[model samples]
Target: MIEIKNLSKIYKDEFLYRNFNCAFEENKVNVILGSSGSGKTTLFRMMLGLEKYEAGQILGFNHKKIAVVFQEDRLVEWMNVYDNVAFVLKSSVEKQEMDKLINKALELVELIDYVNYSVKDLSGGMQRRVVLARAIVCRDSILFMDEPFKGLDDELRLRIITRLKVHWRENRTTVFLITHSQQEGMLLGDIIYKLAEKPVKFYKI
Candidate 1:
């Protein structure tokens, strides 16, 4: 479990979260919800140690393996589909096994046909899927995803979300997904956290 108490991050005139507090259960899907600039992603950054909070307590599985998909695809344009996934996998993967998982991940994201294709050649949605598949295939215990489905169509979103839910369930991995939509947040969240500027509130949605 991860516990955060009285956490705060401030820069100049901006305050990400003041006296923020929460606990994240292990092996569960936790959704962080808010409109733009509501400090949801800011809080995520704090949790990931990307930004330092002024004052608070944050405790979780220390040195736990983490994987992320930022709002941007973050894919290497020059790399082929398989190589991107292979990058994070080297820590615990053999060449042949990595190849197998890359294929499995691409297929899961409906991009198996593009396995040999360069990321530069893929469309936005297709690249998003590849990014997602890369993160998911990391087989990490904790995942942080920021707006991974932003530009996806309804059909693609549902399909990818369904596959993600299934994969997470099978592995019992802990997940933190940040999104602006209530619908998207509620779809796969076991717990929902809402962020606001003045007073942050969290509840089961």
Candidate 2:
């Protein structure tokens, strides 16, 4: 389990979190539902060490590898889908093994056909899938997803979510997903928490 204890964050003289506490179950899909301006993304950034808090301790991730799929599709526009996904992998990984991993991840996102296509030429939704594939191939200890399904249509989103569920089940990767959609929270979350208002706190559902 991962615990956030006595977390406090103040941004521009306003408090985002004050003594906020929460625990996330290991190998589970931990969903955080929060509306705009509720600081959910900030919380993720803090936990990922991209943002700093005034005081707190995030336990159980000391030496673990982490992967993130931000709201933006942060892909290399000049690179093809396969190369973009391969960028995060270590050089020591065998070429055949790396190719296998990339292919499986692309298949999960239903982007196997676009392997050689440049991300700059793909649609927004397709690019997002490329980003997802990159994260999936990492096989990281923890995965942070902040509205990862933004560009995809409802049907595609649902399909990818189902595939992701199977992937997570097989990999046993701890996941923290931040979204405001109730349907998304219900469908994907193994442990759900509602978060809103100032001085952040989470209410488990």
Q: Per-residue lDDT tens digits of candidate 2, residues 9-38?
A: 998798889998888899999999989888
Task: For candidate 2, give the lDDT.
Answer: 0.90
Candidate 1 has a TM-score of 0.94
lDDT over C-alpha atoms for residue 153 of model 2: 97
Q: Tens-digit lDDT track for model 1 on 53-117?
A: 78988898598989888988888899998888788998898888888888878878888988889
Question: Which candidate's TM-score is highest?
Answer: 2
TM-score of 2: 0.96
Give me the overall lDDT of model 1. Answer: 0.84
The CA lDDT of each predicted structure is 0.84, 0.90
lDDT of 2 at 35: 91
